[model samples]
Target: MNAREEILRRLGETPAEPAAYAAIPRPYLRRHHEGDAVELFAERAADYRAEVRRIPGADLPAVLGALRGHYVVPDGLPADWTAGADVVRDDPPVSIAALDALDGVITGCAVAIAETGTVVLDHGPGQGRRALTLVPDHHVVVVESARIAADVPEALERLSPDRPLTFISGPSATSDIELSRVEGVHGPRRLTIVITD
Candidate 1:
């Protein structure tokens, strides 16, 4: 038989109705503990070798000044936040290759999951697009105290489902090749977080 005739005969013999499946039940816990979320987050992030600093809003400029590197900042980032740092504004959007040549990218996060020590970015306002943060060798993020959530479920409540989300727990790394730990394989090698109260 010809290939086209055999395919048509098989198609005519197939069932027309779609199959149905049973629904699954979920009984997962939202939070494991109720300890101070911010403190726990700092401790957990540090465990992944991320440089974390917690300070009052007034002291932000000083902390930022200490980081010496050419960086890319989102257009919505506060002017005073990057007072002394050399920065490129992503107003026109930076090309992927150009971003790789920069020292780092600085941005503000959308929400933080304290339980997982993860910083979630929705690319809103001060948070730049994904490539801006991923291509650079280093990343410096500003996380507000008010936006921290005790756990993942709680954090989800504060975020929009449709937005592009990037969850960062630490500097990019992988140990998959030879079971040896390696950093900066998929993203930045260094991460600095400034938690503001």
Candidate 2:
């Protein structure tokens, strides 16, 4: 037989077997450990270089008002929250340049993950649209204690799949080849998370 005929005959004689795939052993631990969710969240969030404050509900409005500089607040934020600072209501959709010029954006999170020290925003009520949060140089987030989840899985369970979610662990930063760190490359350089009771 010619070389091509010989090779084809050999290939036809070979067995055709389906490859077997071994199932990976996934030891999915639901939670890492047990601890006070709020305290753990504060501690973990602090470790990420984020300012975490446990504020009482009574002091929230005052604290928000006290936040220095001009800030853009979402449409549905409580009327009593601000105490006559240079606060602008983003009713008519603030321009991107306007948002960038503002001092920071104040928002309330949809859920907080204690284990990962993450603040998740669904852009609901007090939380403005995505641009309002991203364009500013600073971001001040207010998270309620009751909304803090024990872990990531728990947090996921709390959030709706359809909404636009932003998960922030710490300030925006990056490291270069020489290990030099730079802040505010893409997002806010400063992040302050206020955990309210």
What lDDT does each candidate get?
0.89, 0.87
- Candidate 2, 86: how far from true, in Å? 2.9
lDDT digits (tens) for residues 1-197 of candidate 2? 89999989988875544342224444677677587999999999999889989988888888887888999889887767665556899999999999989999888889999999999999889888999888899899888899999988778878987899999999888999999999889899999998888
RMSD of each: 6.9, 9.2
Worst ten-residue run, lDDT, model 1? Answer: 17-26
Q: Which 10-residue window in model 2 sums to the lowest lDDT?
A: 17-26
Model 1: per-residue lDDT, tens digit, 103-139? 9999999999888889999999999888988999999
Q: Which stretches of candidate 1 lie over 4 Å from their true place?
A: 1-28
**TM per prediction:** 0.83, 0.83
For residue 9, what is the lDDT in candidate 1?
Answer: 95
